[model samples]
Target chain A: MIAPALHLDGSARYDGTPVFSDLSLRVPAGEWTCLLGPSGVGKSTILRLFAGADTGADFDGSFGADDGAPLDGRMALMAQDDLLLPWLDLRANVAIGARLRGEAPDLARAEATLARVGLAGMETRRPAELSGGQRQRVALARTLMEDRPIVLLDEPFSALDARTRSQMQDLTAETLAARTVLLVTHDPAEAARLGHHILIMGPNSVTPVAPPAGPIPRPVDAADVLGAQADLLRQLRGLPE
Target chain B: MSGWRAGILSALLGVAVWQAVVWATGLPRFILPGPGLVATTIWKSRALIAEHALITMTEVIAGLILGTVLGALSAVGLAASKWARTLVRPMLVFSQAIPVFALAPILTLWFGYGLGSKVVMALIIIYFPVTSSFFDALMRPNRDWIGLARVMGASPARIMWHIRIPAALPGLASGVRLAAVYAPIGAIIGEWVGASKGLGYLMLLANGRAKTDLMFAALIVLAVFTILIHAVVSRIATRLLERY
Candidate 1:
């Protein structure tokens, strides 16, 4: 399948205060694009717009695929919070998207996805029974089960410890390789590690920065990855570079 | 100790204290019958007490089922619509304001001292707690879960049934527990107003005839019945919560 490009142009205001204005960005097909910014710079808001999950935000925008089709039902979002339904077991939670759409949940496929996320034997466990990272992995399994062309992630791994985060990053980079992925995060190192192209979000605009020449997740100790990280830090801190 | 054992132990201790109180006060059986006297009355009048107890049980169980179903539906209606919530919430609160005991006589008069009045009374008593508790819970589903469901294209009705209802069940269970306790009170009050049957009427009749032991026996049976109802309702509620 040919991955569809996403273009979004909008100005958004929350409670009559403008969060961002005249923001425009393009997510190329089948590439991982990381949106790096400080907290509360509306990185997550942008993802919400793409996910069509924006609530109470007055937004004026047009979001469409490269072929000029609306993005509805074509994209799936993994929120900052894992957003696992507490009452559901791991397998049921992974199958919820299908169930919600009035389609019969494929329990077999759900179990397979859970196994892929390394939660093979814990299908019957509730979301509360798992640790934070495990819960996030279950959420990832849910997103993977969605299997949409566009995947929007909002700080999906912020709660994990360093080692687990690295493992998850590798899993995501490999699993979501062919999908158009837009990840929002405040961590420069995470952006350097996972993004094919990193976009530094400012007050009213997003600036694209060229990434190091390698497929992600790149090593944190790689020279080019470290150089990109330093450059991103400078950009975030507004220091002369 | 387990709950059942602890409950039985406490009940025995309570009877011992009661017998001691009767011994120290030197009260006659005509005034304050001792635990042994009450036990004897219970055994001798078992048939009479059981007949009345069964009538009261039927009223309470019928009312519990009807009130729970009606209250749960109302709570769902109120939670789903802004208009219903704005219009009906104050009415629900107002319904509770009219003293329930005062309505007992009116209900008995209207329903003609039959089972109808007692069932209606029990229903009215239980309705408010169930609706208010369940509605409060429905109104405040986990925000993150709701958001995720919305993003996944869940309709409002779907959210209400699949998400809100399941999430709010524990609250509904709590309301049912309160209703279970209150249901017996309603039925007894209605019976006291004008009933020829039920534990309440038996107590009143025994007191009029100076049968203090029989009255005490009926009261004890009623208390035990209430405790049993509460226990059963609690067990069912816990199971429902666990299943969902």
Candidate 2:
């Protein structure tokens, strides 16, 4: 029995501002888990914390990955900003993580990954040359190159057009099939789109509020989802009052 | 568009007025040669003017390369370590404060009135602007970028090499342009103070021999050379920064 990737229990803050506190969650192996919250609820910070991004004393947590799981090196993270190297083209950017790890045949794999994103011809175009959607796709392609068990995605497709965003979600679902994916996003539609178990980050904490539990066959339809996006939005809206 | 054109036309008008003043006053050729006379003189002495111009241009290019390399290296060094910044920063600022005219004489005394002295002079003139500009650019507040890179576990070397260096391009380009203008001027000044060759030396020699035309020729050559260098460097940098 391959156990889950992580069991988290803790809190984090910023300059006396409570980001989220006393959070607990279980991220299983080979499953997509989306963390949903409104803007500034420290969803990104949790992704950061999970990715070992905590600087200073902002985080208090208990995180332990399953032993001997054979993750390719370790955790790989993607952030909200689409932090692709501006100097690199699509191909080079995709392979950067593998190159960092001294992985064999990095560029070849990076090229194939870029092809998966339909960016085959844009291997030489820099990040500044790419559109918002293209850049995010390139970033997703890059994250795939890491070949790691855990992939932390932080609002990666938030800037894309609806069509592109849905297509990207489809591509990511197909391509990142086996990874323990933790995606930080504000949009419930997106969380529903990913069709994973959900972790909703709350005012003072994050609670394990999975999407009705058990396997929900993904490429999930908006109407067939357990939580309607409008309901979630209203729930979020009514929380602080 | 009209405003820019008008400003340029006004400058040409100012030049025409200056030309008229020189002609009407009948000022001594040594004191203030007329524009027409200078133009004719430059045409006549173009070959000789070009030879001296090449010498000055070469010196300027060499000094520009050396000073920029030294300045950028110093900026990196200072940025890399607080100890180096403490030790070297005061000297750099103080060096800029000491009048270039004052420094020129001493440099001539040390490097013996030749290429070395002139190169050092050019270096002294353009070094501070480049060093300070690049230093400030390199250290510019990039909290988001720093946070991103740190979270990604980028090594310090990688962070500086990739992030800081590319981010500093705009400031570095401005500094390069400033240095390009001043580098030739510095070389000319050094040659004016003491040199066996170059347009500045030729201008002085031409003046002594009462060849006012030849002196004007040298001055025009200097102008063309400065424009050419600045344009070329700017184009190359812009192309390189396409990726940046």
What is the TM-score of candidate 1? 0.93
Per-residue lDDT over A20-122 for candidate 2, one digit per residue giving the tens place of the 0 to 100 score:
6787767777788888888877777666666665444477666657664443346667766787767767787776654443444467778888888788877
lDDT tens digits by residue: candidate 2, B110-209: 9987788888888878888888898999989375566555544566666777677777877777788889989987898899899888999999999899
DockQ values per model: 0.57, 0.19
My TM-score estimates for the predictions, one after another, are 0.93, 0.85
| Model 2: how far residue A157 lies from native, Å | 1.2
Candidate 2 segments exceeding 4 Å error: A1-4, A54-57, A60-73, A100-105, A212-222, B1-15, B82-87, B140-154, B166-171, B205-214, B242-244
Query: What is the TM-score of each candidate's chain B when compared with the real chain B?
Result: 0.97, 0.90
Model 1, residue B68: C-alpha shift (Å): 1.3
Candidate 1's docking class is: medium
What is candidate 2's local distance difference test score? 0.75
DockQ metric, candidate 2:
0.19
